[model samples]
Target: MTVTSSERTLLDSIDAQEIVSLTTSLIDAGGENPGDTEEATAKVLAEHCRALGFDVRTVEVAPGRPNVFVSIGSAERPGVLFVGHSDVVPAGTGWTTDPFSAVVRDGRIVGRGACDMKGGLAAVVAAMAAVHRAGLADEHPMTLACLVDEEDTGLGIRAFVAESEQRNYTCCVVAEPTDLVTIVGCRGAANIEVEVRGRSAHAGQPRNGANAISAAARIIGIIEGSQAELDANPDPDLGPATWNVGTIAGGTGTSMVADRCVLAVDRRLLPGESAAGVVGDLRSRIESAELTGSGIDVDITISMEMPGFLTSVNHGLVTTAVQSVIDARFIPNGRSAGSTPAPNGRFAGSTPAEFTDIWTASCDGGFVAQQMGIDTVVLGPGEIENQAHRPDESLAVQQLTDSARAYALIATRIAALPGL
Candidate 1:
């Protein structure tokens, strides 16, 4: 698709420095999970959106947590929605600099949530502002949803979905770290807890007690064996479902036989799998095991579950997003927009390629796509593997600038389509 003069003007209006500055301020605001600081982040975002001549409001999801909504153009029509989370994981130890300082070193923004995903959030804000400033909002309406509690249990998105039952939206774009790729599908996730009970006795006479730890071990073995079965039937895009034994605890002391044991497991699901069904199947398997008549009791429960989503690769949103990235990479001056200068003064990692892939990790996008029946695509600025939740988390400055341009184009193209 060719870039029109109006779209070119809008893209050129995206200020790189402004995006970087806002990203730094957001990182410095410090909305860490397990902490009540998302309010601060929401304030910063609302203030900025208001300054851009847009309608901004904050809806409280909890006592202190709020989701910020920024609107451009009329609410009567179905618009493009940009979804993002304001909360970031807690910054653990082993950093050479302050985690909240928002340092810019070697063309990268170093901070706690720079990559996953304050940078992406800032880019979305910048894109919306640019579109509004270009006098295109009336034709290309847009909304920015800055959510909360995404790192923990997804309370903010749930609240938004509940209130949005009567609202109209064409599609959604979740601003998560995807290394600039368009993610068409993501794996769902669930946390399961298992408990085992047996008779307790002194270790001096092992045969006098039914060992609970031994019974738990048998369940763990079953879980490990199920992985092979899942691997045999993998999804074409999102891959196979798998199980992980995250944590396990049993026994009090070596002098006594254990009577109780607990295990925490993480399960990744395919698009059509349900957490309840998976749990039921596992319970049935455990009940039918040899331990059923061996004087042992077993219990299973699901602590959390997030659904997965799959969008067609041929969808207009996906193709538009890919083209937007390609267009954003080339400027009028024939120089790549997001090229980083190497130590020897040459460009390093300049050209941006189109990559349509799937995400193994779950996100708030699943909730929007599955619950609201909206087509959702995850695309953002940073690399999740090396940048998210690490000691010195950071993202490239050029990526932020390019992402803003790409998002602006996506909004314009999607809104202009007929029968959307």
Candidate 2:
């Protein structure tokens, strides 16, 4: 596909400075998850959307946590949607600068959420502004959804899916930090809590009580034994379904035999796996263990689950996104002189190539793909492994500009398709 004059106009209208300013503002707003402080970020996003003359709506998914929606064009038609999260993980100790400072140095913006998603969020909002400014709002429909609680449980996305049941979105682009590579699939995740119970006894008479900690250790061993089997059958793109024992707590004091133990396990799932199925299989395995005869009782529960998604690489959305990334790289204004090359040696202004990969980390895009049945792809600025959730997290300014341009291109191309 070729870039049209109108598309060029839209791309040119996306100012790099504007995107940087917005990103800085968002970073300064400070939405740290587990703190329930996303309202500040939502307000910043909503203000920007209103300033751009888009119809803005804020829906409260939880107390002091809102999802901001910015829309343009007719609601009656199917549209291209941009999804992003507003929350950031807590800024742990060890930062050279204040995590909320949104500092710019060495041509990179530094902050807590700068790379993980605030930068991506700014790019999407800037793209929408450009699309609206270039008179494209009347040409097609576009929506930008800024959600909360992605860093923790997926409360915002779950609420979005429930409320958007009547809307017909043809495709979704989750502006996650993909280092600009098109992501075709991701692993799903679930949090399983196992509680083991037994009778407590004095330390002097430990054998008189069934040891809950010992039973819990046995269960942990059972979980570990399943890993090799999962590793043997890994998904070609998303990798194997794996298990991680995140937390374990048992026993009150050394003076008495432990009566209870709780184990929190994180399980990554493949496309066909469900939380219920995993829990059932685990429960069955544990029940068949020797704990039944030892007066040990076990209870398992699924605290949270996020489904995985796989979009065909050949889909129009994926193809368009790939082309958009290539096109964005070639734009003179979008190239950063000081930008670092990707791990594969690709850099801005280099010979353009099509790159696609899968995310081991999941996102809200899975919800859109599975529940709404919309074709979805993950593409945005910054490196997930190297930058996101790391101290002094930062994103290159060039990436911010390129991502905005690419998003605008995607919005126009996908909206102008024949059937939609």
Candidate 3:
């Protein structure tokens, strides 16, 4: 493939300053989940798409939150869906700077959503613009779906998948801060709640009550035992299926035997593991315990579950994304000078390399691949370890710029491929 001056010019147009401006505007809006809406943020993003000659649609997922879906090129052929979310988690305490400042200081854009992932969002939008400006939109169909509430319940992506099932999307590329690596798979998450009930009795008469706390303790032990066994057989790429007892509460007072105890569990599922199977196994273990049959009531319930997703390395999307990352590395001086410092053994600079892996954390890719059945790959900018949900969260300007170029190149290549 020969690189044309026009292509180089368009790719060069995706600079750090533009991305930083967009990201700063977005971060300044403070679209935090559970309270704030993304309407304003969506509007900011929509203006960029409209200026790029892309058709933009806003679907209200909630009162003030809207999912921004933009389309470029022809829909008659199979297209690529670029998935991202605009909402950020609440800016918790201990921030030296304003979390919503979106300030460019020390070569990084500091803000709450700068890395996790308003920066990625800006990159994808800019990628689409660059592709269109380079006349690549006519080469294939492209759709940019900016979602809401990815930090909490994934209602935006879930709703988009449900409503757009009939659309001809062959694959999905998610910009999820993979440090510019192409992610092949990600662990799913299930939020489980367990309740153990017993008759309360006076603390002075310990034996009079079938201690619910004791029953809950046994349940916890059972989970720990199962977790150990599960960890023994870890996935080659995904490591292991794991579960943690996140929260437990029981007993009202020191002078009383606790009558009820509730445990909140966070279960991380491997690619092939089903939520039902894991929850069933836990319920069976609790039921089989001697205390359960001895007047203790053990109830298991699944509060929420997000399925895991995996794409074959041989898939067209995966291969194209890998090549795109490799291509992004050659962009001349695309990164800010001395912008990124190596943190935690991970390369801090934007110099690209093949660092594909199954993300240890969960994301909307689960819903896109598992629920929508589209081959989805998690590829994006920024380091997940140090930046996400951390104080003074920032995104490297170079990473953001490089990610846009990669996304633009990948979209063009995927568009030219034969239909699935």
Candidate 4:
């Protein structure tokens, strides 16, 4: 396939308002699973893909886990992959309107997945529509893949990368809530559970028994105490990796020194940090603690984890995204027709090529970048602060439009990919 300016123009000509509606509707509908908001979203995205006249396929990896894939060009062609999860995190409680109801207020769209993702999904649809409207389909091929299970676990992407043998592509764009910044890399995390064993005894003679809760507290001390070491050495982009003692459970009753204590930990990691290294170090820390006569026991198990990944800013995806953003925001050191101060339709820098980019923390980007060997760029609409997940989670109208434009341009540039 060849490239043409008319196709880019067509993609650029997409209606931003419609894109917002499309996204809002999906958010309002919500998905079924923790990641796949609704199975309908898969069908909706498939329709969008088909409407653009692309060859689309849906892979139901698990019982209800549905992943959609559409290729605009042949697999042999150099292409760009736009990857996003069709699923949205669950809407827990509290809301100005129904969490699934697309409420447009003060020019903003509000819903559960409004900012966390649906915003990006809608923009993807608009971008697809643009390629068709602009006739870009005739020149280049781009793959828009929407997967399920990015929220609960990255099973969808994990499955796609594992199940699909012919997935080699040039680069990838993930529509996460990064406020349209080009996020290159970020920290990974480990979700672990620790259990402490002990003997049971009556409160009157507690000294004769082992107190699991007490032993667990000592473990907490070791874990929390280790934070100083983690904080002291921070990654440039992701900053200092931190550990949080999230939950604790132990003992049978107040009157007895009952056995069994459990603690849930959330550990965030930076670049150069490995799970084995972190877990081993933590285990060593626990072992090194003197608990000879404490009458307590301990054990730990990994619950979940996502790895950290980075891409070079010099990579074609990174350079093109940054250049596109600079051109959209700063005066081209000059002026152009219809050029005025509007929302900067550009992505900030952090993803794609692992160069000098600053990603704030861990996300699904970790899975695509590290697990699947796909260079992931975190770029999307809305501020990271506002994805409040309740009490009216929202995405600014302008943010949606801007992100849609950025995705459109990035998709175009990616379709015209360079050697990976």
Candidate 5:
């Protein structure tokens, strides 16, 4: 299938109504209950794959959660992966609708995961479909890796790479919502829990026992001081790393002298830094602190290790995607479409018209870039600010349709590259 400029325009002219219906259907896929939303989400995706004549399969990676993999191009050409997560961040408090219910109001698909990722997922599939309708699969290979559990953790993507080593792909395009920015790099994420212990003391007796809060005071100092080191090593484009004592618990209500304290530490790592090393540093800080003398103990454990991703601007994937975005948004390409900002205020203006910067957030692309060692970039539709884990997350109808067009253009060029 040869995709010419005419083919690009043809796919770009996707039915807005069809996109809204798909969005509503996808939003209704109530797989967010700690269960595999994959079944419902995959059902929608599988139908698209089948209609487009691609090989589709849902591999059960977990008990109820499954990872969906679809391939549209033949094995003869170089394989490129398009990874997207079907799961969304849990809907928070105060939603107007049943979070799962995709309501159409104000010209947007409103629901959980509509912006953070479900929107991206729908757009990617539509892009794939557009590629098929334009008959461009004959020249290039495109694979969609829709995994589960990206909202709670990135293990879904990790499991996919570990389980499926069957096909080797040279590039991965993760459809993470970046508004319109070209994200070439990301900061690593580290989740650590620190604990402290002390003998309970009566409120009336001042010297009877040690105060756990007092013991924790030293621990806090050590952790806070570590910020300098975090900042000492800076990450390009994204400034120096940072750490936060996000959560702290001690004392049983306000009436008693706390005997135990726990610290939940959040550390954002810069490039060239390892998640393990960051944990070790925090551990060393805890041990080196003066809390040990006061019967206070420190425990540091890494709950999550999300590695950062970055490829040179010159990488074929980056070069291609950035050019694709610029052409679609600014250059004389077929990307001059109009879209309104999400319900929340995360976007600037209604449509994309410039080379926006990458967002500071975690995405499955982080794992693919680090785990798969594939040149990756996070590009997609919808404004990100109002969409991520918000009470009201929604994507404009036009944004969904236009993002599909942009992605299709990129896929066509990728598949038709001289040698894969």
Candidate 6:
């Protein structure tokens, strides 16, 4: 589609400086999931939305952690919702630049949260401002939901949905750095701990006691051996389930036989699989291992679980999003604006050459779709490989402006849908 003068004007309304400045400001605020909280960033976002004449509110999802909600439409009508997480993972070591400097150099904004989503958050805010500037808010209703603990526990989104039982949203778009591609679904995540217990004994009398470390090793081997079989049955979009022992700790000293061992397991679940059932299966496997070995005690517990979800490409929200991407081409940067099958052949999207698909990793969008029951899609700037959770995290300058425009176009177009 050709760019219309009015559409060009709307896209031009998105100030690149404003987006960069806001992203920098947010990156400067500490929102590290465990060591820090999003309270400060949430306040900043609330004030920004309020200044634009939108109704905004902040709810504390946890101590020092809050979720900010902004709405431009009446509560009586259905609206579109934008979801962005304000929380970022802890900034581990090794950075060439200051983690929170939000430095802009070489056409990239570098910081801990720049790409893993303060950039996307800035884009959403800029888009909202554009929508307001063009008077699109008056014709269509929409909401922005800024959440906390997306890098860890997802209490913010859980509480947001619980509190919004009376409100209606036609669809949800999560800004999680898809590198300009749309994500229609995502694999779920569940963390489990497998504990092996045995009687401790002196090193001189090793035959007198069972070794927990040996039992744990056996269980690890079993898990590793099952990978091929697990990979054999793949989902149409997300492919196969995966498992990894993220952490393992046990024992006292080399002089004494180990008495206990604990393994922290990270499991990725495909759509249609229940977290409970998956945990149960893992527990059963550990029990079977125990039966075959020395009378070692074995137990499994699910530490956390986030549901996965899938939305068909033919769904209303997806089809509308495809058109919005085409319209976004008005401000072209040489990328195609039509939809096609992704290279992986698992999903479809609006890009000229790439199709939308399910994310291999987990995200809050999965929880939103599974819990809120709203049509959800993940779309934003920054490639996950380029920055997310990595040192010197950054977002391309071009991606920032283009994303704000894309989001503005999406919200405006979705709002015009009949009865939505």
Residue 34 Cα positional deviation in candidate 5, in Å, after optimal superposition: 5.0
The per-model lDDT (C-alpha) reads 0.85, 0.86, 0.81, 0.71, 0.70, 0.80
How badly does each model clash, as a count of residue pairs?
0, 0, 0, 26, 3, 3
The number of the candidate with the highest lDDT is 2
Candidate 2: worst 10 consecutive residues by lDDT? 343-352
Candidate 3 residue spans exceeding 4 A from truth: 1-6, 164-166, 331-354, 418-420
For model 1, give the RMSD to the true fold: 3.7
lDDT of 1 by residue, 1-420 (tens): 677888789989999899999999999999999786799889998998898898998899998899999889878888889999999999999999889889999999999999989999999989988988988887788898999988888888889888944346889899898877888899999999998888788999978888889999999888877888999999987889999999989888797788889999999988789889988988887877777456578888888888899988878788778778767766533655355332123343422123477888899888888888899999999989888999999999988988999899998889766657
Q: Runs in model 4 with CA error above 4 Å? A: 1-8, 32-37, 290-295, 326-357, 415-418
Q: Could you give the candidate ranking by lDDT, starting with the highest?
A: 2, 1, 3, 6, 4, 5
Q: Ranking by TM-score, best first? A: 2, 1, 3, 6, 4, 5
Winner of 2 and 4 under lDDT? 2
Per-prediction TM-score: 0.93, 0.93, 0.91, 0.86, 0.86, 0.90
Between candidates 2 and 6, name the one with more favorable TM-score: 2
Model 2: per-residue Cα lDDT at residue 341: 54
Looking at model 4, residue 408 earns an lDDT score of: 62
Q: Find the 10 residues in a row with the least total lDDT in model 5.
A: 335-344
Flag regions of model 6 displaced more than 4 Å.
1-5, 164-166, 290-295, 329-353, 415-420
TM-score of 3: 0.91
Give the Cα-based TM-score of candidate 5 against the true structure.
Answer: 0.86
* Residue lDDT tens for model 2, 1-420: 566777778888889999999999999999998899999999998988888789999999989999998898778888889999999999998899999989999999999999989999999988888888878776767888899999999999999998844456889999999988989889899999999998899999999887889999999889988888899988877788999999999999898889999999999988879999999988888877766557689999998999999987777787778778767766444544344353235653332233677888999998888887888999999999999999999999999998999998888888756554
lDDT of 2 at 131: 80
Clashing pairs in 6: 348-356, 349-355, 349-356
Error of 4 at 359 (Å): 3.7
lDDT tens readout by residue for model 6, 111-172:
98999899999998888888877887756667888998888867787788778454588888
